[model samples]
Target chain A: MTATAVRAPARRAEKPSSSPRRRISKRNFFARLSLALPAAVVVVPLLAIIVVQGIDLVTHAENLTRPGSADKFIGWGNFTRAFSDPDLLGSIRVTLTYVVAGVGLEMIIGVGIALLLNGRIPGKGVIRAVILIPMVLTPVVAGLMWRLLLDPTSGFVNYLLGVVGLGNDHAFLSDPATALPAIIMVEIWQNTPFVVIIVLAGLESLDPSPFEAAELDGARGFGLLKNVTLPMLGPVLAVVLLLRIIDAVKTFALVNTMTQGGPGTSTLTISNYVYRTGFQTFDIGYSTTLGLIVSVALLILIFPTAGRLMGLRIRRSRG
Target chain B: MKRRPAAVAVRSIVVYIFVLWCIAPIIWLVSTSLKSDVDAFSPTPVWFFIPQFENYVNAWVDGGMGQSMLISTAVGCASAILGITAGLPLAYLTTQIWPPESTGSSRATLAILLLTIVPPVLSLTPFYRALFGVGLTGNAFGLTIIHTFYAILLAVLIFRSFLVNFPREIREAALIDGLGEWRALLSTILPNVWGAMAATFVLALIQSWNEFLYALVLTNGDSQTVPVTIAGFLSFFGTNWARLTAAGVIGALPIVIFAIVVRKHMARGLSFGGVK
Candidate 1:
């Protein structure tokens, strides 16, 4: 059942003739277009506001506390200022590290656990239900819970450490050195289940014929997984990796609740920095500018690959 | 192939260990919630304590979590329903009317994907300003609109994935039998796509409920959602760990339970149908 669902898109690709004969008149075409109207009504205005307000804000010096500062137009000033802004650069670095480290670990740990779970295990249903908990837990609660766990004096982690004669008080979130790492650890803990769940589904849907054939030829265990299983699971892995990266880059709640991007800016992700500038400091103009820059950079960095992986058509320039 | 007892033991142990890791924090949260403030903050683990319900009461009533729960549910359901109402037709238009692989379908899907991946920060301030200008900020209405926008994006993608290969002939056949498009959709397609709609609603509801950033920025006081209210507990209670964990439990319990109940659909929806 799951295999059919997983293969539906691939099946659709092979059966273009299935949809070719659906006749439509001009009125029907308009009616079909009108089907998109409600979504468009909500999305279009918001996109317009982002573009218009973005353009207007990026050119000005509009701090909310300063009266009439919205009128101060200095074209590209915020963008130029961002180039030298140490905090912005630092945030960019922190975000990259967070995405790379957090997502990288999640993929590894998640895939390993999924592989384990895919094999026969007792009480599999109960284990699967338990795995769903962390993925669905509220991020704010996850962060706060981790904060309590990592607390210097009273945290469970510290107590655990003390039990093993590792010394109890490490001040994980308060020390700049350990703050980002602690948050990333929580990121992995909370989201690795996402990877396990999806990859387990993919594993379940695999065509077993290859495994049978390989096993008959002496391929087993690690060899079977390395040769047959991983290759078959390539597309699923790519999609999961892509999705994890997309989600991890927007890591705000974990850092916000845990450190508030503090301990001298160690855990300050791009989202937290932008939120601080826009909401806390009320630097509306520069905040918008920072947002536009980060967004454009992110699009350029991720979406081209995303579009391709998700099978969206894009014109390739011919040599 | 022979069954290896040692390897089976190792695998079971490892899997169980991972499960323990996943749920241990939640266990701590619940246990701490039932402890008194001093016991909750004990330098050592409180392995034994009489469970108390006062913190839960405090969080539910005084911390305003009861109010937040109502707001979150309303917003989540409203947005999910609105999203499906808008998104199902567009998904049908793109996948059923147009070929699933056509430029029309790809473009619509791509647009939704773009909206999905674009960081919400790009629109946060602009939305705040726009909604603030129209007197929608600090209330549930603006956040509902924002959540609904995201839900619509989510719904379109999930529904498209499900309906893309759901042979268009069913709808076409219904239409040919003197039924209008709306009636055909109502009588034929909607019935078939209830699974997709359910998945979309569940995931969208989860998304809206757990969303923190916009809820933090857009709403305050009475209109705050669960995350906003629970996070507020941090400062409001100021290291009253018992009350804090209690509020967190109150806020996170419903969706966590809902998610577990629908875990089968979650893998597909969370991946946007990348997996099944």
Candidate 2:
């Protein structure tokens, strides 16, 4: 590296008449062949797996072959089955409640972090990194870690509450009443970083000129934030909200890990419901049809947002 | 100056509180993992104690976390490599095989993006039945195949950014030189876009490493990875804290290391097109 750096300047010094041989190595066909084959070998199979899976999924179309398995045309058989099945329905309800509440909470918390962290603070980079702890951990780990720390008896949350002279330690996750709240608490702890990062990116993109103008126009701190900063951050906020909503809809590992759809189907989300119905019960065909229905239903909402963002993204990659 | 000092302190203090809230749970997890079984379940709770290393060892050795970790590492790393390589060329094809700035690119990109948003669970039935029909389930290759499907979507999204700005004239001229498309892609294209490829690889690593739902669903017990083992630990032990914490910590280590390395790529992957 040192030799190369030293030679770089020397090479530049003589570059007014550098040799053409060095630049013409692009014609090395065998060399290109070696590299191209490896690249192709590496990439092709990975995609083939997914393409294959997709083909398998669409081609099987269980409802078509196996009548009375799920439903006709796969509209809502899986969904209706899920809705009627107490466990699956419970999971769906839990998932809906959590997605709405959890995402709503995340938006507030995330936007707040974005506002708080934007453009100033002590050791902002370190703060940002530390703040990302929850987001970065594997979801299962996050779930299990919380389980250990929040267990009614020996968990540190109990210990902390003891120190602060709070409520009974065992009351947490001990009853059906508090189990879902406990699950939500764990999720909020685990996923809030997603909101922070998304909203932070939005806040980072805003211009300070508006703030300056607002200040000159006698806009104070809260006033500046309300009228100027919030509006500037709108597009990113929308994107963040949209992304988090879909992600929350896919909430499975956390609920599965912490509660196992448990204490009587309280924490079971729709995805977990599908897992239980299909895999656990061995009702593979029915589960497939049901899961498909849920997918199609969610697809209606997820498609437009996912498409718009991807469109914006493709434009970026191009320009 | 007086107001500024107060404002800065207020900002610092408030932000610190949130950060504390963010980290407090993780700090708690680590601390809880160190407590002995007696101390762990004690209703009174013990904050400070002689730290325990036995749990880590117990988790690694007796807990079978080591084996699960190996499986996860094998699957995660392999799938990431495969996913990125596949995604990059597809992105290249999408970019170059069609004219840039045309409706064709839009359609191609949209087609790929559609694949990304398709909920995994929705296709579970078909995929599971298909896999069973072909005897792919419980096999490592089959698991990799399942992982590659989603990871490829991620790869395409990541790889497309690099491929889009790729100079088309360079490709055109390479073609004019009697070089084949694959040859041009390898020699002329990859070297310039190595950084983006690295980013995609890192993103794939984090994603595949953290992936759980598919692994849990697809793999047989023998091939099941860390997350599945850890999540299902409850069903076996009926809520054994000692074993579960050990398993969770063991499961968390690689992902934590990967997260620190690829934190920036995460910014790209998650933001997707938001950040240029």
Candidate 3:
């Protein structure tokens, strides 16, 4: 496996006769110390803060108002409160919808475009460069740019729609019905290129022998794609899908900039909900509880997905 | 096999439509930035008119984006440097120094990767409280530290992956030639990984430049970055579309140019250095 190869260098003790004897030498000690020191300074404090705050909030609900106060203990109170809250529940639903819809649309469109451009096309280089513009633009700027075009009055979107005989009165960001979809559209526009670039890379690296054989056996058009390409592309697609889903779940900047979770909380993702609760409302205990929940949920989801992706990467490299 | 002319025409049309879709919003942004207020708000879109370069002047001067631009650049550079300083060693230690199959090194790598997976928004309040405790709230150095933490994940991953693929014979030859571990890393390994390092640094810089939540939450007043400053335009001038678009254009120009310059590295970096 490529994973084993990646780790093989470390496993091979350099000059075994020298390794054991020299491993603890002054130079080796300093190297290890250098690594340990920074890791400790950064990772230790971060973990300590998360763990301490999480435990403190769960045990002492009174710390909600004044964090680190550590007053009377109320076991499970914050967790129970979070579970019963309608807003938090709504945020979970909203985030799931956004993640599924945003990732789904991106995968479909990204792969389609990647497949189209994968052929011997003209201007492929220029098209790839232009498509990358949205990905590189600041999320805040992207949201603001969309706001300009999506503005109800004197906006290009409405003007163009009116010219085409479609109604121009729709307030894309202001109406609850259209607000979430509008945000999803922005997310797709910016991130779809990410999928394109990644999948295109995967597509390029694929071996041609299988496709050649399939063609000789009369695989054509949809049949070739269905029987030959897609199956071979499975691992790569899985990796892309997982990464996009994880990234999409953390969607905040666009929502914050464009909608502010507005039009009656239609776009309030769990991230925004946690931000509002902890900072705006200053309910530290409940917010920390919610934050812990989000962290745990993501950890569970990411561990398996990341492991599989890494395994696949190792296998691909080895092959 | 020769393709049908009809199919070829259809493919070209699809590619053109996709390219148009990708660039149209950006084109509109640039066009609006150069349009006069009246022209920008015309009932029918202004497809052709004399470009007004004064809007950029107004946005930079009147909008106070000039100061924010300087701050953003400083933070980006500072954080990227710090990220590399801390991340390179950690990555090298995990992948090259320590036994890779060892539980300690693997766990350490996992922990670092996990730090990245956790939503940054969850850490916002905690980081704010911690930084505020040390009087780091609204401080440029504090903002840089926050950005450094963010950049570390990318730096470590890219470095580790690159090192994993690096040829070991050269390192072993150097070690056999009486080179100290530190000397070997600096003299032998570092030069070889320059490509990955440069890519990591640029990616980190762009990320710091584009970061919004921390900048919005952690910095205020003179510490505000361009993204925050551009967002301020919305609240500051409710409907000044010309100036707002101008501000957006000015703010995005540097990164856009940087991205183009490093388009090759970026194509690799976007896939977490896996593709290249």
Best-fitting candidate, scored by TM-score: 1
Candidate 1 off by > 4 Å: A1-24, A312-319
What DockQ does candidate 3 have relative to the true complex? 0.54
Q: Per-residue lDDT for B1-276 in model 2, tens only?
A: 014767778878888998998888777667767878777667775768998889888777776778778888888788888777667667776665444344545565676666666667776765665666688788666677777766777777766656666667798688668777777888788888676766677767667767777788778666878888887777776656766776777787666766666666566557664653
lDDT of 1 at B116: 79
Better of 1 and 2 by lDDT: 1
Write candidate 3's Cα lDDT for B155-176 as tens digits: 8877776776566667668777
lDDT, candidate 3, A1-319, per-residue tens: 5566545544454454366446557756765677656646766776676676567655665444575555767788888888889998899999999999999999999998888787767788888788888878988889988988898887789988998999876799999999999999999999998888888887888898998898899888889888888888887788778778877888888988898888788989998898788767777667777888887888897876675565465456546
- Tens digits of per-residue lDDT, candidate 2, A1-319, equal 2223212222332331244533544553344344334445634554464456544433332433455643324444444555577665566679888888888887787777777777568888888788777886888888878777777766677777777888546655557887888888777777778878767776665566777777888888788789888876665666677777777888888878777787877777878877876678766656665566677778786887776665554544433
How does model 1 score on DockQ? 0.56
Model 2 / residue B164 / CA error / Å: 3.6
Ranking by DockQ: 1, 3, 2
| Residue pairs in candidate 3 whose N, alpha carbon or C atoms collide under 3 angstroms | none
Minimal lDDT window, size 10, model 1 chain B:
B97-106
Q: Considering the two chains of model 2, state its CAPRI-style docking category.
A: acceptable
TM-score between candidate 2 and the true structure = 0.83
Q: List the residue pairs that clash in candidate 1.
A: none
Q: Model 1: per-residue lDDT, tens digit, A136-192?
A: 899999999999999998999999999999999999999999999999999999999
Query: After TM-score superposition, what is the CA distance of residue B59 in candidate 2 from its true location, in Å?
Result: 1.6
